[model samples]
Structure formats: structure tokens, C-alpha cells
Target: MDLELFLQQLANAISLGSLYALLAIGYTMVYGILRLINFAHGDIFMFGTYMAFYMMTSFLLPWGAAFFIAIILTIAFGVLVEKAAYKPLRNSPRMSIMISAIGASFLIENLAIVVFGGRPKSLPVPDLFNRIIHIGNVSVVSITFITPIITMVALAVLMFIVNKTKTGMAMRAVSKDYEAARLMGIDVNFIITFTFAIGSALAAIGGIMWGLKYPSLLPLMGVMPGLKCFIAAVIGGIGDIRGAVIGGFILGLIEIMLIAVFPELTGYRDAFAFVLLIVILLVKPTGIMGKNIAEKV
Candidate 1:
């Protein structure tokens, strides 16, 4: 590919990768803290987008206000899912929790179909995001450039919260040993809830970005992205925050580059993630940046 074409493809890859990174972080965060995959997370993403859509179109709110409200609502919904689906199974077997997660995911999807209708809704794109920008020989939409910046800023803020704050310390403690953290007076439940809130917020932002980039909404929209991001998280080492970002970028780049170099394989783009997952499992089960952890008896 020529330099201009390569740059264009690269921009698209980065934008796609940033969205994956944002969503992958949520998976990693919850897995890190609770060792549970929030299967309903993708639905939570869909929920946020729909909420924003309605707020803008039905409520007649500005895009900024709609997005803010959507994020808040998504966070609350996420927390509610935790309390209803996962919290009760906290002390139960891991299999039980996983099943509950799956059930919750299905419940949300069906509910969305019932309430939002089966027809796909078009997300109202803001002019700011729709504007085209030119740089030398490469031209792209504003969101193509904006996505990576937002991802980076979100990552930085998350890192600071996870590494520098008291809550961060508590989260680490709880992750290590929930009972021990509770014994030490840390509110384990609260920490878990907070983690979900943050994860949900990231999902909300990612959903909004995805809506802007794709501009189409469906009840099942989050399923593929959710599964892909889960793959990204696992590939990057599920519990490592930085690793999740790396995994997302790697997945995005590979997907875009594969299709660009060989358009015939475009049909198999989704399969690539699974193939990569299998390779990673065989080569380095702990992931590129993951450390081996012994399971407790």
C-alpha cells in the first residue's frame, strides 16, 4: 500500500482499536476484581447508546447532555445488574456466576428487542464528529482522530485511579483476598460495585464512540464487540489493565491490516480474533503481560 493509503488504513485501525481498548478495559477491570466476566456488559453498552439516542431524539436534549445522562444511567444499570445477578452468587460456585452472567445478557437483549423494537435505529451523529479533516494526502472524519485521544485520556485517568487512590488500594486488597480485605475493614462489596461503575462508564463511552463510527444500533449490536473485547482482554492478560489496551490495539491492527492486504479474507475478519485467541492460549496462556497466579484451594 502507498503511504497515503497506509495512513488512512492506520487511522481507521487506531480508531477501531481505541474503541476496543475502551470496552476491553471494562472486561479486564471486572475480571481483575471479581474474577467474573460481566457477559451483560455488551448489553450495557447497547443500553447506553439507546439511552443517548432517545435522550437526543425523544427528549430533545443536546448531544452533550444526552451522552452525560446516558453514561450515568448506564453506570446505574451496571451496578443494578451486579446486585441482582452476580451479587447473590458471590459466595456460590464460579460456574453459577458465569451462568447467571449469561442469563443476564440474554435477558437484556430480549428486553431491548421488546422495548426498543426490532428495527435498527440510526444514532444522530453530531456535526462536530461528522466533520472531515485533511492532513497532507490523508483525509478522515473527526472521530477518526478524536477516538484515540479519548481512549488515551480515559486510560490515563483510570490508571491514576487504580494506582494512586485509596480506593485503588482497597480494590487491590479486595482482588487479592476478599475475606481478608473485609477483615481489614475494607468494604469489599463497595469496592466491587465501584469497579463495576467504572467499567460501565467506560462501556458507555465506548458505546457512544461506536455509535458515532457505525451510526447504526441494534439490540444485538453489542454481542460481537463484547465477545471480541473479551477476547482482547484475555489475549492481553485478563486482569492487567495495560495489557488489555495492548491486546485491543493488536486485535484492531490485525483485523484492519488483514482485510486491507487481502480483501478476500474480509469475510473471515471475526474469525481472526478466535484464531488469535487459540494461538495465544497455546503459546502463552498467561497472556503477553500476565503473570502466573496459583489458584487457592
Candidate 2:
């Protein structure tokens, strides 16, 4: 490939990888605390984009305000989902909880269809995001440059929260041993809710960015990205934040580069995630950054 073409593709990969990292962080965080994959997480992403879309198009809100409101709504919805669906099944069988999660996902998707209509809508991109820059022989959009910076800042803040604060300590305690944390006076429920809120917020940010890059809105849009982010999380060591970011970058790069090298495989791009996932599971189920913990006999 030509140097300019390669540079453009690299920019695309970085932008896509940053988004995957955002979504993967949410999955990893929830799995860390609840040990359950929030199947509805992707739907939450869809919800965020729609919220921003309506806020801008219908309510005539500024993009910045709409984005902020969408994040807040996503966080609220996530907490509500936990309280209404997952909370009730918390002490029940794991199967029951998993089933509930699936149900919630379907419910959200259908509701989105009913509410947002089945048709795909064009997302309104801000002029700022569309601004283009030329670097050497390559052209790049503003969002492409902004995404990695945002991802790095978010990652740094998240790491500080996870490693430095009291809440982070509580999260660690709960993840390690929920009953033990409760016995020690930790509010396990609150921590779980907080974790969900954080995860949902990250998902919202990702969804907004996704919409900016792709500019299409559909209720089911989250399905593929959600699954891919989950794959990214698993590849990065499911519960490890740093691992999720690394895995996202790796997956994004591979997926982009694959298409670059062989244009004929454009239709098979989505399949790449699953293919990589299966290989990772077979070779190292624990993932690159994952630590294998021995189960107590």
C-alpha cells in the first residue's frame, strides 16, 4: 500500500480502536463487579445516540448540551435497568439473571423500534467534527484525531478512580468477595449501581462517537459493536480495564488492516471479530492481560 493510503487507514484504525476501547471498558467494568455481561449494554449505546439525536433535532439543543444530557440519561437508564431487572434476580440462580439480561436487551431493542421507528435515521454531525486536516500525504477528520485523545483522557481518569479512590477500593473488594465486602459494611448494591452507571456513561460516549463517524442511527446498531466490544474485553482479560483498551486497539488495527490489504473481504469485516475471538479463546482464554485465578476446591 502507498504511504498516504496506509496513513489514512491507520487513522481510521485508531479512531475505531478508541471507540472499541470505550465500549470494552464498560463491559470489563460490569463483569468485574457483577460477573455478568450486561447484554443490554449495547442497546444502551443505541439509546444514547438516539437521545442525542432527538435532543439536537427535535429539542433544538446544542450538540454539547445534547451530548451531556444523553450521557446522563444513559446512566440513569442503566441504573434503572439494574434496579428493576437485575436487582430482583440478584440472589436468584445465575441462569435466571442471564435470562433477565437477555429479556432486557430485547425489551430495549423493541422499545427503540416502537419509539424511534424501524427506519434508519441520519445523525447530525457538528461542523467541528467534520473539519478535515492534512498530515503529510494523508487527510484526516477532526473526530479521528479527537477520539484517541478522549480515549486516553478517559482511560487515565478511570484508572485513577479504580486505583486511587475509596469507591475504587470498594469495587475491588466487591469483585474479590461480595459477601465478604458486605460483611465488612460495604454497600454492595450501591457499588454495583455505580459501576453500571459508569459503564453506561462510557457506552454513551462510545455511541456518540460512533454516530459521528458513521452517522447512521438504528435501534439494532449496537448489536454488532456490543458483541465486538465484548470480544475485545475478553481478548484483553475480561475484567481488566487496561487489557480492554489494549485488546480494542489490537482488534481495531487487525480489522482495518485486513480490509486494507484485501479489499475483497470488506463484506467479511464483521466476521473477523468472531474469528479472532475463537482463536483467542482456544489459545489463551484468560486473554493477554488476564490472570488465571485458580478456583477453590
lDDT, candidate 2, residue 168? Answer: 94
Model 1, C-alpha of 209: deviation from truth (Å): 0.3
Mind sharing the TM-score for model 1? Answer: 0.99
lDDT of each: 0.94, 0.94
How big is the positional error of residue 272 in model 2, measured in Å on the Cα after superposition?
0.5
Per-residue lDDT of candidate 1, residues 1-297 (tens digit): 789998999999999999999999999999999888999999999999999999999999999999999999999999999999999999998889999999999999999999999999999999999998999978999999999999999999999998999999999999899999999999998999999999999999999999999999999999999999999998999999999999999999999988998989999999999999999999999887889988765
The candidate that achieves the highest TM-score relative to the unseen native structure: 1
Off by over 4 Å in 1: none
Q: How far is candidate 2 from the true structure (C-alpha RMSD, Å)?
A: 1.1
